[model samples]
Target: MSPYDDVEQTGMGTHGAKESGMDERATLLDFPGADELMAAGQVGEPSAQALSGALARVGTAAAAEAAGRGTGDVAATPVRRLSARRRVLVGMFTAAAVAAGAVTYANAGAGSAAPTGTGTRGETRAAGAGVFLNDMSTVAASQSATTGKYWKTHTKAGDTYLSQSMDFYVMNDGKAYKKGRRPDWQFGPKNVDWKGLDQLTTDPAKLLQLLRTPAKTNDIAPFDQATALLGDTPASPKLRAGVFKAMAGLKGVRLVGAVKDSTGRGGTALEFQEARSLGRVTVDPKTSAILEYTFTWTSGPSKGKVTHDTILSMGFTDRIG
Candidate 1:
């Protein structure tokens, strides 16, 4: 039998009590009335699968912690020893599993008036944003990709983090070349080289998965990542189409309707409400390219403050200016 079988088969049995000593006995005292609470409808019972999964996760975390400390001797650890730390971890995991079930059950009985996720909350609002984005995807996919050794862009941008609006140019030929910043050719947030970009999938769902991979060095918000691709990168028409399609799925994103960029170019706008600020991106549907992105602080000392970036021009070129 596997290690999880031991957890399934036994509890504080005679064998466990002998190995665990007084600390385990004292910890057990805290849960003396758990069965009574379950019987009185004050607590819900979790599925066996949920409990098993929780135990497996706890075991994995414990093994990882042990390896990190240079112990690397999980196999040598006794299941019955029940150290205070292990007892707490196991209890917390088990409680979390039960709590998940209880919350689901409670929500099921909450009736139609209960609030829904962004996908269903305001159907008209969500539908409008989704339709516009999907239409842009179609337009983008139909466009032929430009060909050149260097991809170049001219942009003016400012954010709460920057002291003033700065006009800049970025040219990339495998490595990035930019003005008014680093002496190094590589600059700005970490992005894949052309070789890495080629590895990215064009399927909307899969593209989002790759962009949101936890191991990526540029681990920021997905919205920011998508806009970055639409901004300065040499993303192909197909890839840009995938990015637009994927963006329709982001939570809390809604239509902001027609808007004009800093350059007075008309575009469709969509905004996402983040925890502390609101982010809005405007796209010029005519060319299926991003025109501007803005953030307005919703809380903290910078409440009501706004910052923006506007794209003047972007395309692949034979030379850098």
Candidate 2:
């Protein structure tokens, strides 16, 4: 089940109540830290992993090469191409999880205790991707973490359901995650309590190991979800810092400086170049909560095509609606 596996991978619960457009990119094989994480006992046998880290690097080049070294295959949404990043995961971790249906993320509750964070940024602070993520993580860790019974998000995206290319949408759900489900009006809940995330150490190295360890059906979506879960859900500030650090290591990704979201809120952003695609995450300058997740086409026929989800509002709730 390589990230190259011909399995029909669709966006998770993406059939929205509107209109849009889309396409799919294959997963890249990864070999980035398999041996290192394995030696440190973060994952299983190093040999068992298809997407270590080296393969991720190679997969990107390979995808670009397959497309004649163009940028990305930015056309249809149903077909999945490979990238260096998704290669290793789909080739190894994601493939296995897709087959065995054994990949599950931690959803338990986290303690109410809050961790002190570090650093502060102005409305338009500028830094490299690595530094920006690290600084934001410090701020996140410092916020007092409170647990809630429910998880909700007010995200606005460009009709991701085959380019449903629409407007603001909200997701409200319980903590339960059902695999292979369509988008919901009031979806089941996901935890922000950070209870299940305790095993994820604060060390960037160890935290990255956990982020990559999850077996997912889709190569790229998991990456977005991994980081997006921080602002969309509840977690300790230290845990958020770890996630930021982990994602900062992604290839071709960098800080894009201060920007505004659809809501016209000021925030800092980090982005990565994926083939013909670019993905960016923006965060509130003061609170450090994620403000938006944006993906746009930089090349191909769909160039300038963009879709993003803005976290208008989210937090722990007492009950589901």
Against the true structure, candidate 1 reaches a TM-score of 0.50
Residue 22 lDDT (model 1): 54
lDDT of residue 28 for candidate 2: 27
Model 2, position 232: C-alpha lDDT score? 50
Error of 1 at 299 (Å): 2.2
Which pairs clash inside model 1?
A: none
How do the residues 1-321 of candidate 1 rate in per-residue lDDT, one tens digit apiece? 422222322345677665555554444433312322222233345468766765676677667755664644444555444343454454444344433332111111111112222322212111245555655665576567777665555676321111011223443444433355212111123345554455567898876665556433443566777777777567788888888878766656677666788889877677777688888888875567888889899999999999988887777656545
Tens digits of per-residue lDDT for model 2, 296-316: 999999999998777777766
Runs in model 2 deviating more than 4 A are: 1-126, 156-196, 210-218, 221-225, 299-304
Q: Which candidate comes out best when scored by lDDT? A: 1
